[model samples]
Target: MTPKRLHLILLAFATTSWVRADLATNLVAYWDFEGTADNHSSASGGAAYHGTLVGNAAVTGGTALAGTGSLVLDGDGDYLDVATIVDVNQAWTASAWYRPDLAPAGTARMMVFETSGNNSFAISFGLRESGNPASTNHQTVVDTTPTNDLFGNRDIADTLTAETWNHVALAFTPATATVAGSVVTYINGLVSQTLVIPAGSTLIIPDSGFHVGTYRNADGRWFDGSIDEVAIWNRTLSRNDVTELYERGAASLGLTADLAAAGKAFVSVESSDPALGETFGTGLYDLNESVLIEAVPKDGSLFTGWSAPFGAEPDFFNLTVTASVTLTAGFAQDTADPDADGLTNYQEIVLYFTDPDLADTDSDQISDGDEVLESLTNPLVSQLNAVNWIAANLGGGTEPGDIVLTRDSGTNTLSFKLKIDSSETLQSWGPLLPAATSSSGVAAGLIAVSFPPPWVDKGFFRVVGEAP
Candidate 1:
């Protein structure tokens, strides 16, 4: 083959693979009750291909069975059989929408039994054995829980609602051993509680036909209501998927043709096509939406009404600016300086921890007045720049004998005086004092030393003069 043709074929395959990655499998089973109308035999109703519902059981809602059905299993011989096509030993979820009638005496049970022994796993809802006739006891149990009294031994009670179509889901996981482990029940898309199953036990009864509506051997406790949209999955569904089912199911019942557009599949014992009655397949399950970023504040403050982004697609929402706005370089005093020079009280407190009231905050050994005069460092505890002052004044070309510093111990003051010899050039003087020394001194009798500022403490003067 030509190189051009081979490259084109490879590109086409790559494109197809990318498209297939976005698609997910759809699993749906539809059971429409419109075939050979049989009364008791499996042949009477549409090919007992899936199972059977006995005793005054017939599909209702529409003529062709495209709508709803009432599977009334109340009397001694009323039940529905769900034929086992696949082994459900792994994680699975079963859900249904049911509406029951208020019975007079006995409680109701929803059983899933095996074809052989009556000891198959089951869950029931109704009044407790000790419950008064007036109140109800909504109990849920597994096969491990004793079924001797049928109504007394249950893992959970007071969870079922009656006389209305309620969405019920049971999720099973094999790994968990706690009561909340193996099983979880959901009512109306919300998780109700975790169910406890027997250790080393599987909920799916092996080699047994899955039965619904009535207990295995017990009588008088039958589901006398309409069961629609019964679905079973090989895996537990996420919370989002459950919510989608509730919304789509409600929309479908409301006679919306675009109901599947809500991104969920509908499963039921009644099929839309007679040929597909026993078969389950995938349906509408794709809802692709884009996610956008949301902006938020960053002002280092607490936000009260903060909410995350939400929609059909992923969304990014902006958070209120909670970042701290640091006042960097705005203060008058330098943070690197231990003492603040000519700064206000607020600046001293914010920048350097110097006593804004006194010029020499730290009573080191030099006054603030002499520190400025001899080009010495400030003696404030925070602003004492002794190391930088010594490096600048003493380490340079300035002779050590030219600078002088005097401290009066009694008056607690310091005076810094610097005098230059007549022979010294003015250009050489510039290197000795980088700038003019603010002190009362005579520099070659030309530049007079004016006292810049006097401080109270003598020890606060950080400058000492070297004798000439």
Candidate 2:
């Protein structure tokens, strides 16, 4: 059958169960600093600069602007803004990978900012004491600087690699207590430190225009080295949350590059390569975090295009298999071939399907022909309770006339054998059969039979026919 036509439901008879899955988004933005060759200007007069691809990791063989580019390679201010787009008063986050040729002194190298007065805020990385340009001492600085207590600072003089790329991220929560609603910084994938403002700190700036590359104040420390994969989020990110961002950039970071585009919550920035890169802007707001973007496989489903090791579970639920039967099917006659391949019709119905002639239906293991003759319920069809019930009743009787049932773990099937004794009459046998057993001729003595080894496990078999 076509992959679309097969479906099956395998009931796992287990006391405990679990399924595995993952939840998160991998956002991509201008990676490798590749930008558009032509400068795109916003209505506010800010020019969008294109980054030129550099290094050996070009998207194309001969240095296509797809990966590895020099920032400001065109000499025009590779600056972009989100002042008109982002809601400044709400919580947000901004991050990037920057390698500056010159230490930003006396000025804020704005990664993301807005111009509105009451709702505006900015995130920058630079020297803590901006006045000393010649001094090598620098700190990972945030906020608008001393003008507001919102500044979260970390000393980075020892961490700065002059010409190498460094991953940086900042998460902001506006207007709340300093510690509760503030910014967090991550260097590489780890949180370097956290800054908190006291409850009544004066660093609140409600609205303002946001700028990237060079701060709007124009103190003149233009971002000289390459800036790649800049992103902005409308919500604050926790320390654990920032770790996710670091992971998304791990691929690029290993190559000394960033993802080719900005992903969700991404707005604007300057990079060395635009074509080899990508960045997100306004579209990120549409994603739903609660829903799973990927699909999972269900039990008894046919798995087409499945490749070896064969034992692993299917990755998705796109294919179908035979319809599942329930414990209610116990009353029906054995519809499957018995002893053809050493399987009973009841076993085949439990394991594969009602059609006994078909051997290895799904072709995974345990022959369909064999499953039929055993009278064992299909492991996929029988519920956990049913399996437990069979296990509990396997060998409880004392007299030779008592019935015994067992399960085969290797084949996952159930088996049964009846016992009759000279003392027991035929009338006693009537009560044991799955169906009503009536007296015939003279009452013969009962015989005793013992269940097999594999079927002894409490996990394997269940009663099908009534006592006879």
Q: What is the lDDT of every predicted structure here?
A: 0.43, 0.40
Model 2 spans with C-alpha error above 4 angstroms: 1-33, 37-70, 73-78, 102-122, 127-158, 175-179, 200-203, 206-208, 253-468
Best by lDDT: 1
lDDT of 2 by residue, 10-84 (tens): 233221122100112222122333434432221222333222232221222222222454234111243443343
Q: Estimate each model's TM-score.
A: 0.44, 0.37
Q: For candidate 1, write residues 1-468 as lDDT tens digits.
A: 999999999988754431211111222233333332322212212334465656655556422212444354443556666555234556666665655544522354443222223555433332243223235444455443322332234434444454655666666665434433355766666666676555554443534545555555435455555555555556666544465455545554321223334443332111222221221221223343221222222222111221111122212332121111110011121223233345444444543445655656566444454454553454454333553454345433445554455445444454455444432554433334434444555343346433555644333233445533
Q: In candidate 2, residue 73 scores what lDDT?
A: 18
Index of the highest-TM-score prediction = 1
lDDT of 2 at 236: 67
User: Model 1, residue 38: what's the lDDT?
Assistant: 28
Error of 1 at 382 (Å): 30
